[model samples]
Target chain A: MNERPIHVVGGGIAGLVAAITAAEGGAPVVLHEGGARLGGRAVGSAERPWVNLGPHVVFTDGALVRWLRQRRIDVPLCGPMVRGVRMLDDRGARFPFRQGLQLLPTILRREAPVDETFRAWAENTFGDASADLLCRLGGLITYHHDPGALSARFMWDRYRRTALSPDRVRWVAGGWVSLVDALAERARTLGVRIELDDRLTPESLPDAPTVVATKLSGAGRLLERDLSWPGARTALLDVATTADPGWPAVIADVRSDLATCCMIERETAADPAALGEEGGHLIQAQLGVAPGVGVAEGVSRIEDGLDVGFPGWREAVGWRRAQIVVDGTGAVDPPGTTWRDRPSVEQGDDVFLAGDAVAAPGFLSEVSVNSAVQAGRLALDARRRRAFAPGWPTAELTPERRLAVLAAVLPSAELTTTTVPGADEVAPVDETGPGYRIERRAGVTRATAATAGKGGVRVTRVVASALPGVARAAVERLPVWRRPFRR
Target chain B: MENQVRAAQGGDPFAMDALLTELAPWVGRLCSSIALDKGDDAMQETLISVLKNLPTLREPAAFRGWVRRIAVREALRAATGDRAIAVAEMPEVAVAPDFETAVDIRDTLTKLPPSRRAVLVLRYLEDLSEHEVAELLGTPEGTVKSGLHRARESFREHWREA
Candidate 1:
């Protein structure tokens, strides 16, 4: 068995999934978290009992639940939310049954096109009112201010997922805190070494198969690559009330075509012990706000909806909190791009990306799970290559061998500005092994020195400095001129 | 998958890139197995051909078959164009002391002519029927059958000599 560790950065769902998957595949795993805690967005704060940054629901049919169930990771879950679903329309009345029936026919309609906008396609397929309602209701899943402008394929897939089988939606009983705890425990059981509060930069990264599961922007900074994708911005409101008023379980306010719908879920109604032994209703409402819309303005709109839905809710409120989360939800594909068009997972440089925004396909947090699994599998393959080859000195890599090299090099992007760490930056190699130094300049890989001769080859000097084009072309396109120095 | 094909055909560079990524490993494997040392050249040529003719492909479902034919043809061309046919021709055949050691399949493969290697790879490695191999190679089934028979006999003869 290869004991070489696959390092994972970030402690989010993606990071945890990657670590566990790689570790279970028989690779020694070391997970690093910048923060002191394990869960990133999944668990808000250790002090807060079960409250999260927002109300998160994991569907039984989705990838997240399937992955968890397969691994036997026990997490208490709430119902499929069948009863008390009050959908308020723009007329300030309940979701008209006739209009709702129109959407059901769309369930049997032809698949959506990838290039067209969802709004255009939905309006053409269904009527204007149905389209508007579909896009607004999309806020419940996307948390995007304008879901209609997104790709038809993106919106349609999620729409079918939710609308077709509404019963698939399940909530984590005690919040994602429990799920996070379960994942951490599973990772530990698989012998994953967890490092807390250890933030790693690209240059400082160990020369090992690694997964960077941080948020897209953070990954870009770490890898010195402009890794970006579309994410959702929404206002989150957490309200705790003293009275357990008989309010609908979830109220979706699609009261205006101009504004996205506001969704409020009463947690206490689902789980009586949601707050504590002495149960108090914890209602979490989220409203997608357009650009320049302040959290206060979004909160105000949501409160207005709450006034219509939950009567006397303002008077019953014990405490309430409102804030805006920018680009917090998974990812939103624009008019033309699919999930494949997002930032790719296989970031050449022994560093794979595993997150919601990366290339792997699924709904919401499911994307993170899918991407992490893929990144883990890729990291395992890389680990296998290194373990088998044992520092091969061949400069002319076969197309097959180049894949090994693909998972090996952390290209020289900004390492000159980055003060170098210890010699074991990539991975701890034997001092006498054939370890060739990496040097890059202008989208080409160069090996400056090889510290090997009689005993064996050791990479002597690694100079990691190159132009910004490294992200776009350096790794994927080496221009056939990149041949590392022969030992 | 069809969506990717359609997008690539419609001149989406990103879609083409994705398609290349999806097909690279399989193409590399086929090219390396048949073309040997010139596998790199064969892979590059095959991908170039695949991407260039992507627009001409009418049915996206037949993509794998189409790519397989191209890969086989490119690999055979690369192998036959090589100047190193006499690499081991002049050497005296030597038997190894470890009698139970199986012949290194890749090494054994390198000894055959390019066409013969293609026949063997298509027949055994790809698990294609003799008729399928002949059709893929644009040759008669009789020629495929005879080529396969002769190839097996030659392998046995080599083993006996060793």
Candidate 2:
């Protein structure tokens, strides 16, 4: 049947790129997505203030930029240089990091009100309080963990720049999704077929070639039969407002290590006009929201569907907002984890893998998209040269066993299991059945802020990686105010 | 907000305006989204990059892809540049805007990494083919094609969540 048009599984960025390249290379491509759409984690959330993963940044050296330009993803060049950074600490101390040495003198001369001993030195341009705050926020925002535990170099990588110029920072005139939409149109024009809600399995693909590109957990699920890798979790804060907050377009990771409840409500009084001159768009790290009685309570941290919970989150912002907190560790893959660890592209192994999990030095990075694209193209090239084998993996441990191992390895409190479509049976980690199931009810919180200047909001859901138990516990622990807003 | 491509390709000032009108908002949104709290810095730099690089664009029709690439590059440069300065006491700019809900498009694009998302948008929404995208990007057609394929898959997955 014409070789089934080179089946591609997992329609994340990497998979999409693979499909495009295959079609361009004169191979008809059919892409399978287990979900209802494409773009994977790059888009959508059930809550608000809606935020994206990684703010979805791209670099000049990456392949995606070149591809977009080739296809005319028309957008202007906002420069890549940031003018400055502003950081706030647990005590509400504010600091700024700006371009050029002149600003250094100004920053160093300042003193904070919280502590008389605190004096800003010329070298302390981002501010000590904020820097301390950044340590925690940087951990959560950049690595989905505490910043103190991460590499300082990696922590600094997010803010380090080559120039002190004012215009190095840039943006797209539209939101991140606009660019995604534009790409979809381009794919359609190239006669590339896209399917949503089409999850994939090994058998779903043809023998020609394939690429699997998603986050670590997703990638692991796809490759459970082939290999094992570490997984990660993420939390995102989405906020919507009526006025421009007059803040910088980008800022450093300044996680306020305040009380969890205080942290949740910290931004409630934020003046949108003061955050940025432009309205309704922002990307920043280390944000906090205070807890309110009603719609303002935070979601819980779930563990094994029981109520092992965190304190109820408070609401500090009046805008409509939600936070997504994932629990997967997403630890860095063991060193030397690469295509070499598996079958060689030149050795004719047909099964291919791609994602941030494969390419990143840590849990995630701006380079993940590049890794996906690179892996897909490499697979295509191998297939074209007849260098791939159609054989998939069957090993000492079956999918069910592997899942069992996974449950055992992970913190038991946060996981539950069920049988997927083809599994022999559905079992929990504690169960002795041949087949098992594991599931975590991600914690999602929706809050409404009624501050002075912002719009009165409806429901918002915060997403987090927690056991279902933790989620339930957090929900019950939620202040009485949020009981009516349950989704 | 100038049509650097048309100008470089021998068009008049009017072309620059058309280009600006068509592309500026999209670029602005992109910068804000990624730059987040620091979007203005990124947006301003991106605009300047666009203005400065306009003269180098060789094709008027391929302007969209080229400009979008430049924006992403500019944003990255900005983020990285800020980190290099790393003074502990600097006042970070306040938070920027959240552009997610402001503009509406297909959810599939979200699956793409930032880079691929740019390509998908340029290729599809802007109606530029692979070669045109490649020309604007100064890369090979093959690279563009490969990126498009992966980006499509990403879109399919993300669209489901939306």
Candidate 3:
């Protein structure tokens, strides 16, 4: 019965998710947030309450929504309204129906190789026009100036999910403020001690399992590890107006080949409360800018698109804010690299990472959810693995041997296993432990118990028996010639 | 909503996925309240049954009630079929520092039998009356009343902190 609390740093989505996941299993958790409030980039500052930093939407198909559903956290969502979708090419705010039909085959093509660049793959798979259009459209989803230079697999996977027909997008009614509050409430309910404005240095961190869920730059400084990754720099423009010019729900501006596209979403179209003012509409626009592109230039370019999409938008503006965001939108994989090549979750000595940039899959914030859940599970396992029923006749054995022993003893138990992509499935035996559910599939990468996860069924729960150990020991006592499992 | 359901029934994978997302939280909450640790398995079983028999549902308006009935039935079957690892038999893990604050109502409800827990969950959690609970569980109103009384008494006994 170890009561030591797992510490989670930062109160952002990753930190909150990690804390909740850890605490749900009865483990004590303490969350440290440097800011006065939660919801890192997911929400806005006090000046603009409930307004997302830029534009944010949750796809019903992503990991974030899945986690919300699994945890039963009710987030009010508005279904997709694909009615007013304007495409901005060189001409103006038009559908570009003919051009869209041409790119349909490329978008529908499912798989793309990781080694190839998105530009190269699209050109080879479809045509030069296809590559040019996709790379431009890519700016809307990935706020990257040069998505054409990124990995094909990375961009393609995101494009399929992001640009799917009818758009599975669900706008959070109160922005992510509602989600953050719900997560914070859930964390507190699970007895997760929350400390606001409590930033910790490397020296000040507790000597317990901790989830460092801050941005990579902060995490690199705190963990003192080189956690650098390629991220995006984009310009954000949010304007509030009472003018109802009947603006499109979203505008993808890919007019100039010199400057990449920008995505403009009218939040009021989906949820009227977005503006926080009566008869007001919130028009938010964001576009990827090249390295030297300043805020002035980015905002002007966004205005050009706005002019085409919403006529008389300039005079109708009541309040507007524009800024340049650097590394705000997670990592972007280069031509040859993949998400697997990003910073890993398992930092040695029981310190795990949980954030958008860490090595996990999904689109945008979905990456955070995936990594947070993984980090939380690993941290929980790390903290509790040593505390099996105090009297189970314990013996510390290798993870593989432990699984082997469990297989040897529990010969009649129902075997439940998920096959590792590149590794052999651990042969398991089953029957008597009616409640024994096995998910052990992870350790093939390394033999370490922490990474042995998702699979390495805790044989410590079953293998701590004399009968199991005897079976394994008797078999091991034999020489290599006498080994039965040797293939 | 009917069109979405029809699309799902017509085997559109994306539509089906969206429907699952829409209904998952409700189903998850119900299954968890009844099945406790077995809630996940119960939810999966319930979802499969719901999706498989969706075509058989004549009234799309009755979807919510019908789904609730299926969820309760699946949860009960899952819980009743398996003799749970009794709360007392659980390994004596050290309680979190704020254990009192974190103690879920489910922990105390585990002290009662599954049937009593069901009645309590249906009556209170579902906000249904004793008569409604009787109809839901297919029991007499008197039986429902007495079962609910015992469940509440057991809760009061177990949840001294509350």
Interface RMSD of each: 11.7, 24.6, 15.5
TM-score of chain B of each: 0.78, 0.47, 0.76
TM-score on alpha carbons, each prediction: 0.62, 0.44, 0.64
Compared with the true structure, what per-residue lDDT tens digits does model 1 show for residues A186-293?
A: 999889999999999877887668899999999999889799998888999988898866788888888774446788888777777666537578888888888899
User: Native contacts recovered by candidate 2, as a share?
Assistant: 0.00
lDDT per residue as tens, model 2, A374-432? 45555544553342111111112222223322322222222233222322212111111
Report how far residue A26 has shifted in candidate 1, in Å. Answer: 0.4
lDDT by residue (B1-162, candidate 1, tens digit) is 467678778754335444554566557667877888888778777777777788899999998889999988888779878443322232322432222333554566666566767777777556689989888887778777876774565453443343
lDDT of each: 0.72, 0.40, 0.70
Off by over 4 Å in 2: A1-4, A46-54, A60-63, A75-84, A90-137, A151-169, A202-205, A226-232, A244-321, A327-348, A360-365, A387-487, B1-162
Interface RMSD of 1: 11.7
Q: For each candidate, what's the DockQ?
A: 0.02, 0.01, 0.02
Write model 3 residue lDDT over A371-461, tens digit each, in one string.
8977886786676433321111111223333233233333232222332333222211111011111221211100111112343322223
Candidate 2 versus the native: TM-score?
A: 0.44
For model 3, how does the per-residue alpha-carbon lDDT over B1-162 read when each residue is reduced to its tens digit?
455577666644334444554455457667867777777767777776777787898888787778888988888888778554332233332332232332446555455556666777677556688887878777778777765563465443433322
